[model samples]
Target: MSTDKGQYFNDLRTIQANLPTEYSRTFGQMIVHYYLHLIKSSHTQKANAKGLKQQAAGILQEFKRKQSLRKDYPATDLLVWVAESNHLPQALPVTSLLKEKKYRVTYISNKQQLLANPALEGYNKIQVVLPKRGIIAEKQVKEFEAVVSSIIANTNLAIITAEDIDTISKAFREYVTYTRQLQADYEKVITNVNPKAALIGYDIPTEGRTLTDVLNAKSIPTFMIQHGAMAKVDGIFGTHISKTIFVYGEVSKQVLKDSGTKADIKITGAPYLDELMKKLHTAGSKAQGKLKVLVAFSGPGHLTTENHHKKSIEAVMEVAKNHSGSVEFYFKLHPKDNRSYYTAEMEGKNLTNVHFKLPHSQSNDIFDWALFADIMLTGASTVAIEAMLCRKPVISLDLTGDYKELSFVKEGAVKLISDKAELNTVIEQAVLQNFDAFDASSRKAELYAKQFYGPTDGQAAQRCAQLIEPSLN
Candidate 1:
């Protein structure tokens, strides 16, 4: 292995050491062990290093072969970059609507699995290749090195430790290096596709940000589609990358405005949730007998702490003890959360009525869960808004006492509970189907839905398509 590889491994070790205990225990430990083994084996045996290189080459060759099989379609007026499978639903509708307007469309994605998406059937699908490490040139290397150095020098040592600084520098170096490599490929694709306009969903870290930069350099008008709730701390939204941003509602538009974003903002609701919300509204109120509560669990990390998880379980168990056979609890785990961690956490707890629902796929319809649930509970998840869209009462378990400023709580979309006593009272009211008893009214939920999600009349896709069409000309 090269000296740079060894240094990278050392940096990973430094990062692993400084990571929070919960993160290190759950996920970061595996990454640390993988790099440790790779570095150790490379030093021990040259053959092992050769074998690892061969394995990577084999993976790359297979990827190229699959990409070669994709049929090339003529350049289109619009190019839609699908970053994640979750974004496909939002992108697909806009692309489909564009096709109806006689505009040719091409779809590109880094994840090959998305090519099989039924929604992407009629569109052209192209697989994106992320540049491998060590492919960056020396000139680019110096440029990125300077950028990393400046970042490190500017960082406050009081708040960030030397180890943290080193780890971040190393990570950013890799990001810049890979991004430079991917930029060349993206430039080539854009030149070949020659789209008059491009569409992307959210520009933050990784591929989306890099792609936005490339599109801006090429003078292509790129529109950013809102994917989810925008927080105040999400500084990436304020960057002047895309030409325009299509947000879900006026609230999101204002958030970007307050953040001093340079892009033009338009309210188009949520394209992906539009149809789902329409269907849910048409289905009317579900027949209720027993109290059905849906608990949306946040992924383990800064969003939800171990203490929050423990206390949430304790509070829910207490509520269950009182209601017993009259109520049922459905615990929905976040896509990134480990099912085993939640299962182990609930072990030995005598709660027969509580059931766990693990995320099966990116296409899993959470709206169905919202439809049946009379009330939803979560710590700080976007699903609270989804539940409110379905007219279901939302209860935020603020056991950690840190989520006082969450958008749902601030907007009165959810009832915040900080203790077992509050949890019991909220659950009791929810069970009786009299959430208004606790001052959590249906009118508040309705207003929140409108302000947060705009009009969910199944026309957001059309609005987005219309917004992108004029830019193409």
Candidate 2:
């Protein structure tokens, strides 16, 4: 299994260097993000390339499609906060708390559907940034296409063929056009809103970069919020253009530092975790029926194979099937995961107590699952950290043996397990015992968790608000 990008990343970096400085800053770097996701979960080059060509063809089609719109943003004086993936639950309390501080925050989302979320209901101004629009300027295609060919031809990739470069180059041109449209739309937003300052999600994502670039040129300081922990290949980390990045804790801050991050990092805690912190301090009594077990699905690609992810779920379901009388299982999917495929798997099973939770912007989040379950089961997802922070026991299920030792596990905040039989045993014992039986383990988990993301006083959002409030005036 290919644990690291190895030669492929070297090849891509070579391409990044080949592109002219102008395009290299945005589009060239975007090329890297595209491939990072492409093979992010695939542990082997064989698995990674299984459908890569077809995927590339599809991406070309998507690039050539109309995905954004041109809009005349109205004039305003609000401080614009652009969150593509970091909407509602993730940006929580920080956005709301800032509003309370009298910062008229205009929330912009790239996911068009997020504006309707009930969690964002009380917000005064919320809008969606259309993801893409029809191709804009065809004016400068040949020159960039030549640059694309030069970059592709010179780079020796572990995946993709010389023949693939032709299709890929065309897509690159389309992306250039799409990115140009994004630049135009954002410029319009700037001209109309005259944003006070800016706050964005990740430093990656061409969309976020376009916004940051436009905002930066206007001397608007942009702050990025850290929603998840950083892994080595999560993306290009050191290349941030934001003035500063707001992180969850020192652990994340240190990781960013090691990755050569240039931006100043402020540990503001995690707003979602802060909510869990409040509930952790005064958790209501557990219902007296079956033992509640929550299975938080995360990192099928980054941590395990898609097949192994399925195996982990099957293991949980089997344990539930065997202990139906004593235990209930809740499967919480990552927002990017599809529920329909899993829905079909549960169709014929008589596992009546098995529950499925589809988490959206405003719906039940991982914290709610952590709070409601007696024991949490995951594959070392970031949720394991969040669940532990909520004072819940977390078991990391490893199927392909591709597990890495994260700090939390070394700190004993999470336990890594592989045997399915052992999973059944844990469920049976916990269900047969008192609800408080796992209380000691839960408390122990919290001790390590505090070191990971602590001060569980539930003020992470407040801390972020305090930092951003000063720049408003």
User: CA shift at 132, candidate 1, in angstroms?
Assistant: 3.0
What are the lDDT scores of the predictions, listed in order?
A: 0.66, 0.64
Model 2: residue 56 alpha-carbon error in angstroms: 25
Clash pairs, candidate 2, are 2-43, 41-301, 67-132, 68-132, 68-133
lDDT of 1 by residue, 265-383 (tens): 89998889766765677543744688888888676433455556766776786787688788888877776565675565567767777777523433357787777677788877878
Which residue pairs in candidate 1 have backbone atoms (N, alpha carbon, C) closer than 3 angstroms, thus clashing? Answer: none
Please give the lDDT score for candidate 1.
Answer: 0.66
Error of 2 at 356 (Å): 1.7
Ten residues in sequence with the least summed lDDT for candidate 2: 41-50
**Which segments of candidate 1 are over 4 A away from where they belong?**
1-73, 135-164, 231-233, 282-286, 305-324, 357-363, 432-438
Worst 10 residues of 1 by lDDT: 24-33
Could you give me the TM-score of model 1 versus the true structure? Answer: 0.78
Clashes of each: 0, 5
Write one digit per residue (lDDT tens) for candidate 2, span 57-143: 666645543332344544433444545444456575788877776666666766546666677775645354443324535556667
